[model samples]
Target: MHPRLKAVSFAVATLLAGAASAQSATHIAVTDAPDAQSATADAPASTALSRVTVQGARVRELPISSGALGARTDLETPFSTRQVTAEDLDARQVKSLGKIFANDASVMSLGDTFSFNAYSINVRGIPLDDYNGYKINGLPFFMTTVELPVESFESVQLLKGSSGFMYGFGAPGGIINFVTKKPTDKTLFSADLGYRSDGVFSEHIDAGGRVGDDRRFGYRLNLTHEQGDTYNGANVQRNSGSLGLDARLTSALTWTADAIYQSRRVKGGVQDFFLDDFNGDTLPKAPSGRKNLGAAYDNTFFNSNVFFVSSGLRWQIDPNWSAKVDVSRSQDRRRYSGQWMGLLNGAGDYTVYLNKAQGAATYEQAQALVEGEFTAAGLRHQVTLGLAWQGLNKQTVPKSLYTPIGQENLYAPITPLSWNGSYDDSLQYHNYHSAQKAVFASDTVQFSEQWSALLGLRYSDYDQTSFNTAGTVTNQYHKTPVTPTVALMFRARPDTLLYASYVESLEQGSTVGQTYVNKDEVLAPLKSRQYEIGAKHEGRDWGATAALFEIDRGAEYANAQNVYVSNGQIRLRGAELNGYWNLPAGLRLTGSAAWTAGKYRETDAELVGHRLEGIPKWQGSIGASQKIPGVEGLSANAELHYYARFDADSANKYKLPGYSTVNLGVSYETQIAAHPVTLRAGVDNVFNRNYWGFLQSGYTFVGAPRTLGVNAKIEL
Candidate 1:
């Protein structure tokens, strides 16, 4: 199969699967079970979501069902938030986390896995790690340095701008909050079978319902099995499962527990590939003169287990107010090892890097909190006060798997080999991990019938240690931060509203926040501040919003600029304008574009007037969904991503030119056995435009090529 066709296969499979699931559920036992898999809320009882698995509390709440900016995907809404609903994900057949954000302008991918390093996501032009600490039902899923499968999440929420108050510390750019699917309170079953152009085949079974006939006890289970080659042809496979249970002890009390386990066999990037560009070129191409991606590892890593348990109760103290309390604990354990291979120097011979390295990590978290909501002065107010704690541990051992260029023996590019056969290699690493703790409180106050105000603050303390197996050990460091934020919302009319906010967030300098030579030189946690105002209006089938926002950031690490001062404080100030018009002539159009003026304000560095590195000065996208009368279940849609000129490096010294690209997909889906069956095909880079999104050591994570696929899904 052609490389591009493999990607196209996945795309087609996704759209068809979605159309099937949406149409087939009506007659199945699906709708019969309420609170079972967030059934279509279109039932018309109350325009509220049926349930929410939030902060250890599993309660059916209607607060978020309102609209996009306020509830739905409001483009002009301050804060700029977006959600990939479970329903849409089903139709799209999105497998990797990166795939979900492919078309989104607000989220940028840092590209491939180096040592299985996950693709980096920049929210508001800042690394995502600075926002919410990666969490899963209150546990640290990110503890293991492995590529976590994105399927574990039913929906992914990317919130742009300031939300630091909710998580204590975060980036001014925003945060990515993934809401995992929970056990259904009612009864349900979902099975999915799929195949993509990448030679990947998969099977999944997700089932849930009341544990017994009483309906007070319920449990859910998910299982996935898959194997195939990715865009680079490295064979890929994984087996994973998760179990969940929720029980209602009394009208006001509840308890829920969940666990996930998986063992994966993967070909760590024999050769990770990249495209020269992603933002500017609608057409795509492999950067010039690059070896096709390959997986040369003779080793394997099993990303093993993650589990959590918790109990909570919502007590209606009185008609005017209510109190809720919940506590949960979770743990993540993983072990992996692999030999790393390197590209050949100017000569044609291949190179061997690390012979073999074995690594393991355990991440744990605990949370206990009390929250309250009440009606006051013809308005409503909600607040949460709590204490949160997190811990992490990591260790690794060295084993000789391959001979280096200077070694006596040479490593070959043939099949995977136990190159370490009989070689005596010492365990050379013994670094214990780090820990973090924080106490925070946030409140939403309705100041008047037409407006509300929000205020929040959090204080945190963190510490870490790193050591090699040798007799020597490194000292540890600590960080403490106090952050505060405020915002206001005013109702312009029943169909229109305006919001303005000044929100602040902080990130403890840790991941890349440390400098070994100078303890004082260690970065202060990065600071992010934002100001935003936007309006929302809607009537009949039409809705629109326009927002203007600005954000500032303090840089922490070098994106690899040759200069030291390159890590100085940087700022991104811009306005994001977006909207969608659903007209009467069978046409629905939507797109958003933004402009940013940025620079490094620190020392006398070589960079000034240059836009921030790796960021496009202007980026926006437009897509359309059309209705056709002649073709049954057929729809054609296209979207374009445009990025203006940008600086390739910090010191205005080097710059990479900007580019643009367009993507088109058409689908024809119809119901089968009550489940929708769909066929889709499209060309990603319509003209095969050649460009580079950014350059680092001349390596690029290539944009996907043209691909096609077909998929079927059934629901009951």
Candidate 2:
């Protein structure tokens, strides 16, 4: 065996032995019971007791439900899963979804977030944007071309691996599930006010309650508005609202619905430059991070209006069998206007253009599942059979003409151009349609109290078609694929699980970028695979997990003829360690580390062995939080994030320098005029370190500067 693999194996064995000896007093049951496999809200006492730590007690026992796995705790599952709860988000005053991964080493931000419209991320070394990469309550929710209302979600859950069998035709970067905040059984109301360093201000209101004597109907509503100068020197304004409702028609049936509206507009467009237009073997020198190079008259805007509705029917067929059916529909509409520029000469001359576009997509999904438990030949088995269908249709109108707006000098800038919103063929349209129908089944077999195995398979038929501006069919694709998953888990002790899994994913093939000659062309479906092994420990006061994984996926590159093709392969192998611990003196420590190697294994362009773009080989973070020794309602926390140097292009000729940043925060909880109030203040990028952020897609942007934020929440 390779030395690295040998070392990981030895460590796993040692940990298993140590856990067994240390926790022999307790026992855990690994039974193939129908109820045990069903998603539930009940949790062990030990798990509940652990939510008493320093940073608002991030819960460890939250049940996660996605794909065919149903609802289960992270420790009992055979995959790498992490979650950030509402309490954690509030305690840290998390600004956006991109910032949520600062403490998670396995995920990386790949684009500037000065505006929600440009945010993108990479999970386990696979890049994914809002589109084709996010879900709300296990159903498709726009994240690609539309912005999600983060305030409406109760928690953010990340499943890191190839989830094709669970979510058909998705990117191989893993799945991001947003669990909406459900209606409360009791009346609740809250309000919050906040301020940012750059003169930004915000307000939010949230309310939920049950109606009627029996409390069968529940409702929740949220509203928020924020506007100000952002850390990146962009003027941003955002407004959002959401409503959730659920009604119990009978003992076995429930109906739920959601309506959300969000819009973001930037008066001064943020910094985003492309390297393709520059003529140099190495990347050009970046201008001042604080300089505003955008034309004074240019602005970027993004707006989204989404409506979603779902219903569920649960029936108990027999003593050991149950069935469920779920159906949902979502429609999202978006509008965008923006531009990106690139320096063309040493004199600080650059090229800039303005464009406007509009898009709308509708997603419909349905699922049916049946689960049963039985014993045969002295072994226990839990079986699940499911069928699912998804349909998505989209229409878009893009700007047909690019009129260059002269750029200004870097050292001294002046407005060089203005626009009156006139364009050629601005209403030209394109239509797209995609559909997937799948049938899947899984069985978990328990041979003894300590051993269990899961086997699953999914068969799917996918269809896609596109229409040009003239309403003529331009492209069509159809494919039927089968994906399989297998895993085995062993309970080393009552609190420890050692597991290994193999999973495969299927995704839409490469789509040539706008910069390529055949920009609108699409390829066939691509198949990717992942192999992983890991260990998880869930204790009364602490939790930890470690894993080693490798992923191989299809990639695209420009050949010697300058034609883009999908005849390329990318591979990523890495190890991750993440966990949190609480000390006796009310201090809590959390840490995460990842080391990855990404390579272009094969390519038509002489790029074999070159490092993949925008992927840092080493990334990690560490945090500490503690309650003040003498202050009953005060706590202080700090964290540091680090990234290793990485390449910005496939050729590996240009690279980005490594950088690190630190953040500090403090919070106090007390009563204000008899109402419970919490005050929080924090500083991000404390040193105002200037560095290049993401460099994927041949575009580079500067990181955020040091910024201060203060917030206060009052319970009513």
lDDT of prediction 1: 0.50
Tens digits of lDDT, candidate 2, 419-514: 765655446465777888999988889888889998889999989888887888888989888888888888888778888888888887655655
Worst 10 residues of 2 by lDDT: 41-50
Task: Output the worst ten-in-a-row residue range by lDDT, candidate 1.
Answer: 41-50
Error of 2 at 665 (Å): 0.5
RMSD of each: 10.4, 5.4
Per the 3 Å backbone cut-off, how many clashing residue pairs does candidate 2 have? 4
TM-score, candidate 2, is 0.90
Writing each residue's lDDT as its tens digit, candidate 1 over 201-293 gives 777776777865567887767777877764444455777776666677766565666666666665644322221112332222234212223
